[model samples]
Target: MKNTLPVTRYYGSKRKIINQIWEFIESENLEFDSTLDIFGGTGTFSYKAKIEGKEAHYSDIFKFNTLIGKALIQNNTHKITDAELNFVLTKDDNFNYKFFIKEIFSDIYYLEHENELIDIMVQNINRLKNYYSKYIAYYALFQTCLIKRPFNTFHRKNLNLRTNDVERQFGNKVTWEKSIEDLFRKFCIEANSYIFNNNRKNTATKSSALSCTKTADLIYIDPPYVSEKGSHVDYHSRYHFLEALVNYETFKDYVNFEKLNHEVKLGKTLEFESKTSISNDISSLIQKYNNKIIVFSYRNKGIPSIKELKNIFIENNMCCRICLIKTHSYALNKSNKALGEYLFIAKPKK
Candidate 1:
């Protein structure tokens, strides 16, 4: 069966291992009435829990990602209406749409015309009064932006990589060439299809893992991974453009002017991205949710090695089990060697 979940090309997305994660949950017979996906990057896991008849509470530090969770996970019966879709697609000649994208983003990330289209569409989306409709529109727009990018990431200032005439070993040129309107509509349809109530109230909150007060029967932690080889995945830096888009009103202030792509500078750093702070960060999380059945998703090659994580659980007086799920390699991890997905399941001793 095709995975119809609301997903984007997020770097650490669990879309591929979702079934395996679910299978693990099933095999353990871990019955839970509710689940909290603390670092809900793409909300794939929370959406899966909702589909499986669990009250899903999703939280993310990024506003853009939280909007996605709100649209797909928390939203029970709301979908973008035909009228709203028409409003977003239709351009009003009389209305003076803001030229933020056309002026600042010209020749940087997208073509001049494409940037103008984004400005216009974003303006139209803001005119929406219904919160759910607005979120769904933004979700579609986010996915549209990802599909058009060369590597589905805004990590580098490389518009030339997509536009230049050169033989490429990777990327879909046709998909990149598609109009933003077409891609927006395509994702809108996909997002709409994933909207339904599982008879449980779901929630999406804007919070950091350390600050989130919500508790659940089960907690899934998919913190940003730091590779043992000293590579770090900073999601805020990778998707800063989308982060800027969601916070367009105050976005100009956050722009890192030194950068060529006009990437947003997230004022704060996450400990999870730092080698020195990772173990402490993971330890803090384990201590916080020590009472719940804590499940962590980690890569075999990640820092705070599998053995280290097991020791952390053991130190917390919890019984831990490690399950390895074989999966495809990520673009970031360019090692030709194989990689394994690790799930660390820890239950507090009674």
Candidate 2:
């Protein structure tokens, strides 16, 4: 079974051990009525919640993630007809969907003649939308497709999903167009029944993970383990679209990228940039909500000792229990492991 939402090249996506995640949640017998993934990367937790029939809430500081979340979790699913495809892809008929290509490829000026090729891709995607959901179907191949651009992220950015660009990349005299196309077709055939077939839920915007404040029976947090490390998440650079999403309409202050610099200046954003501090705020939240179970995912990287967490929880009338999760080795050095993730389960006494 092709998981409609198979793992892609996400850096910290939980898709790696979704089963393990499910085990933790199910084993704890967490209330299925409400759940939250404050550090929703791939949003596997929230995604899983929706799949399992839970009222789920997820938030991330990244807008790129939010865009994907909106499309995958929020948007009302549309059957995606062949007519839309015809409108988007085939220019021969009345509808010339060239603008669609322009929107996504507005930044693709460097590659030689790549702009023209993007137009072709736009057409192809439009025509193909009928075969699958526009969100998952189009990008299944395009997003991960080997395109031989400068960064070499794809190994080859020129080739897209089909047609031919093998010559443009490594000059390999191989025609992978057919092979990739076949895989895409197969993926779409199976993906159609899984994700696209299901009704999507609503995803809110400009909200923090704890913003849903109406205490869930359980709350899961995987905030950045350190204050200095959050800098690694230059969300504006990584997910610039988020700046556009928030309507700080009156506030010219850049809310995404430029805002990071501001956060640095204001000290609201940290040099390292995790939201673990939200846990401290939970001490405040406990005044209103009662009998809350909290689970937090943490790594040894600069985390306060478990004692610190214990103190925080205790002060808030919660009991904190820590469980060892996994230790991952560095990619370059298999024997080296500087950190491991810890699961902190806290039950509120208040």
Give each model's whole-structure lDDT. 0.85, 0.46
TM-scores of the candidates in the order shown: 0.95, 0.60
For model 1, the superposed segments whose C-alpha errors exceed 4 Å read 1-3, 329-336
Question: Candidate 1 on 1-350: residue-level lDDT in tens?
Answer: 22467655888788877989989988888878999999998999999999888899999888999999999999998999878988998889999777777776778788888898888888899889999999999999999998888778887778898899999987888999999989998888888998998888899998888889988999999998788885564888788888878777678777776878877875346657788898998999999999899989988777798889899999888897899887766554446465678898889998
Which regions of candidate 2 fall more than 4 Å away from where they truly are?
Answer: 1-5, 61-63, 74-79, 82-193, 196-206, 210-215, 225-235, 241-291, 327-336
Among all candidates shown, the one with the greatest TM-score? 1
What TM-score does model 1 achieve against the real structure? 0.95
Error of 2 at 201 (Å): 6.1
